[model samples]
Target: MKIMNPSLDISWTHCGDGDDARYGKSVKRKVDRVESDGRKVLLDTNDSAFDFIPTAEPSPGTIEDK
Candidate 1:
């Protein structure tokens, strides 16, 4: 699997209903990648049932000086 951001935090939630309702819970994951068509791939699993939102905070080094 191609990791676009190893440390990136992703808040994923299943958007499916009915029989797939069991998977309709929000969870957080670290490993993620973005497809060329603007789809978020989580853990290398490509499923359209979930929507991913990036929740990673900026690194300390990127936010403040040492």
Candidate 2:
């Protein structure tokens, strides 16, 4: 991965061994990652919404906790 602009670009690469590349179904499989040279991937989760609930009004003889 690399920082080229306001965002980052990522890539993937994989190869097989022992004549596995002949059939194209290589024994090696690469997964999508933020780093290619075996480095830690920094990522954060984003919440799409705010969760808030309004409290009910106190009744004539109801007690509320502060």
Candidate 3:
């Protein structure tokens, strides 16, 4: 089903490079969020083995560091 209110949210974030720590697996992700059917949710890839985080990508006039 296509999302009615596909809140278009985007951001620049650090992501994992696909490798294990012990087995040299080290990775990270820049999380993002979306709104659909009156509910907020995260945007993620289907290949990840974990859910790191889910949050709003900063909006204009919002607080952020330089």
lDDT of 1 at 35: 73
Give per-residue CA lDDT, model 2, range 1-66, as digits (tens).
Answer: 553442232332333334643343322212224456765343322211111112223244322222
- CA lDDT, every prediction? 0.38, 0.30, 0.36
Candidate 2 Cα RMSD (Å): 24.2
Deviating ranges (above 4 Å) for candidate 1: 1-27, 44-66
Best by TM-score: 1
lDDT (tens digit, per residue) of candidate 3 on 1-66: 343332332233233334442342223332445345544354365433333322324344432221
Q: Which order, best to worst by TM-score?
A: 1, 3, 2
Please say which candidate is ahead in lDDT: 1 or 3.
1
Error of 1 at 48 (Å): 21
**What is the number of residue pairs that collide in model 3?**
8
> For candidate 1, lDDT tens digit of each residue in 1-66?
354453342323433344554353433443366678966555534332233323333343222111
Which whole-number lDDT from 0 to 100 does residue 20 have in model 3? 42
In model 3, where do residues sit more than 4 Å from their true spots? 1-31, 36-38, 49-66
Of 1 and 2, the candidate ahead on TM-score is 1
